[model samples]
Target: MEWIILALVAGVIGYGIVIYNGLVALRNRVRNAFSQIDVQLQRRYDLIPNLVETAKGYMAHERETLEAVIAARNRAHSAAQRAAGTSGADAGALGAGAVGELASAEAALGGMLTRFFALAEAYPDLKANQNMAQLQEELASTENRIAFARQAYNDAVMTYNTRREQFPDSIVANSFNFTAAELWQLENAEARQAPRVSFGNR
Candidate 1:
């Protein structure tokens, strides 16, 4: 009887250990995924200055549009930093509030970028400028990378959330104080629509 009771206790302890370790692993994966998004967003932010500068000379009439892009980029950069930092915290690890901040900021930035690109359509000389063309290409590529990174980050969050919410794992998650992660969402309707981009001719 003693041996049997000891064996049962050992089994429960071992199972608990496994669950705890799995939760830790999931949390780390979430962190790494957010970091990937931060890196891509940082790249996008760095490219914005060059893009704005290149457009300035030819877009003399659309000063507000250019300034809007810069302002939006700054806001997005700050939000991305906050998201990265909040994911580091234990209490709200990947909470909706933190990630939502980034999503909203990025959505605003996307809308501004769309407007900026639409402005490009009106400026023939700007379209013709090699620097502007190159910057546009780079920005598009960075956007693609950011999309992929966001997808990966969301996937990680989904997995972590599933593990945290499921029964057996949830028990471990609760004991360890693991919180649910938030998905990155598009908040701007304009951002959802296809951008009007006609760079060449009319």
Candidate 2:
């Protein structure tokens, strides 16, 4: 009888330990995913200035668009900092919708930059500037990295969400207050973006 009681106690302890460790692993994975996003965001922040300068010389008249981009970048930077500072909070400090709006603004800014480049094509001098070309290349690369990071973040969120919704893990997660993560979803403007169809004049 003594051995059976001891065995039961040991089994319960082992089961609890397993649940704890599993939760920890999932939490760490979610964190690592966020770190990946942070790295990419930092890269984007670093690259934005050069991009702005490159577009400035070429599109001085488009101050409104440029200002919008800068404002959006600032908002995104602030939100990211807040989200980082708010440790263990399930609801984002800046709210998920705000973050999504900032992301949409970045996309709009990118599209505007494309328009700037198209405008620059008319000016051979700007296109030929070595500095502008380099900045453009770096900005393009940074955009690609951001896309990859966003995909990774979404993947991590999915993993975290799955654990929160699963069987034994779900119970443990609730007991410990583990929450699901949000993905970088496109905003309404992004959805409303019409497909570009360039056709020769009829």
List the global CA lDDT of all models: 0.81, 0.64
TM-score of 2: 0.77
Prediction-by-prediction clash tally:
0, 0
Q: Which regions of candidate 2 deviate over 4 angstroms?
A: 87-122, 188-202
Top candidate when judged by lDDT against the true structure: 1
lDDT of 1 by residue, 76-180 (tens): 898888777777787645655878888888888888888888768877878888887777777777777778888888898888899889998888888888888
Off by over 4 Å in 1: 193-202
Give model 1's clash tally. Answer: 0
| Tens digit of per-residue lDDT, candidate 2, span 1-202 | 9999999999987987798677677667666666677777777777666766766877777777667667766767776776555434553212345446546655665565555555556556566677766766666666667777777777877777787778877787777777666667765564333222111121
lDDT of 1 at 150: 82
Native RMSD of candidate 2 (Å) = 5.0
The alpha-carbon lDDT assigned to residue 40 of candidate 1 equals 80
Measured on C-alpha atoms, candidate 1 has an lDDT of 0.81
lDDT assessment of candidate 2 = 0.64
